[model samples]
Target: MKEQSSRKGFAKFTTLDIVLMAMLAAANAVMTVYLSQVNQALNGLGGPIATSTITGLYMIYGLLAYYIIRKPGTALITYGIGAVVQSFMGSAYGILSCFAAAACYLIIAEAVFAAFRYKNWSLPVMMFTGGAMVPVWFFFAAQMFGYTKWGTGVLLVALCVRIMSGILLCGLLTKLLGDALSRSGLLRRFAVSRAVES
Candidate 1:
């Protein structure tokens, strides 16, 4: 029963989290609407680009959710929920694209977190969690949408863009969130768990 309860908790995000994610998705819509042309232009110029890295909204969403619910399925639920919320709201991405994005995030994040047994809430692990956003970022926005279908060179460039965004923006945001959560004492047990790992 306790385990079931824990699972439920992992699957459930608070009302605050929901509101935050919805806002994020709405912003994504606005950004995409306004900046997609620039993004296309940059990709044309750079041979693949990290345009989505501009806002760093999704990174914050993932990091904040992980910070609050440091348990298995939490990352997946929050990411998936955020995508759904974004699609349901007036966000830029269509419902199909949102589904694709949510699936990529859910699968990759679960794989990484499961490998770590879902307890590595340290800075690095959290960073990796944020890093996982990269593939989905491209998978949904670029590949599924036919951007990567341009050519092999374009595909490789897209991959580079994803990695660059993950490292520079997502990773940094995750570390910042972890630090803030540590300061807030919301992640005390996670701190000890990280210490044990080291």
Candidate 2:
């Protein structure tokens, strides 16, 4: 029999895993509403840069899910579900855009994780994945909102701010939260907890 600690069965999801994903999806739904309000509040005062800064918080759902699940495609499945939940909750950009954005984000994150062979969840790796969404976001925004008109300089500046936000909020904050949860023994069944034990 394959040892429980082995990654051989990591590709499969258990009923408990499905239930956890659903709960995370629901949490993401709440975050979407909260983020919309935060975006609205920041929009007039801070423009795209300010708004995107807060977007790092959006990465939390995927990060937390991935940390716990520690499975290939976990980010894709969790965040894709998050987008659907957000769409049903009513996104101004519509359901399709949310889905597309989630898909793009997943691609970036998966690439980063894959680069490490999904064995190293080091800070640098996490930070790289956290910021990976910026390029994808820039392309998607240009297509959706004619953001190209803003000029490359302005866009680049906004992207930098977003990357920093991702590093701090998504990468650092997720690590902090994961550590706290692991320490509390609340995540004892998760891979992260096992990693901590080892």
All models: lDDT?
0.60, 0.79
lDDT of 2 by residue, 27-110 (tens): 978877788888888978888777878867877778777777777878778888888888888886677778887887788877
Tell me, by TM-score, which candidate is best: 2
| Residue pair clashes in candidate 1 | 29-92
Runs in model 2 lying further than 4 Å from the true structure: 1-11
Best by lDDT: 2
Tell me the TM-score of model 2.
Answer: 0.89
Shift in Å, residue 97, candidate 2: 1.5
Model 1: per-residue Cα lDDT over 1-198, one tens digit each: 999998787556555555554554455445455555676676576545545444344445555555545555655656676676666654454678766766776677677778888666566776666666676657557645677667878676657656656655666666676567656765555533244335
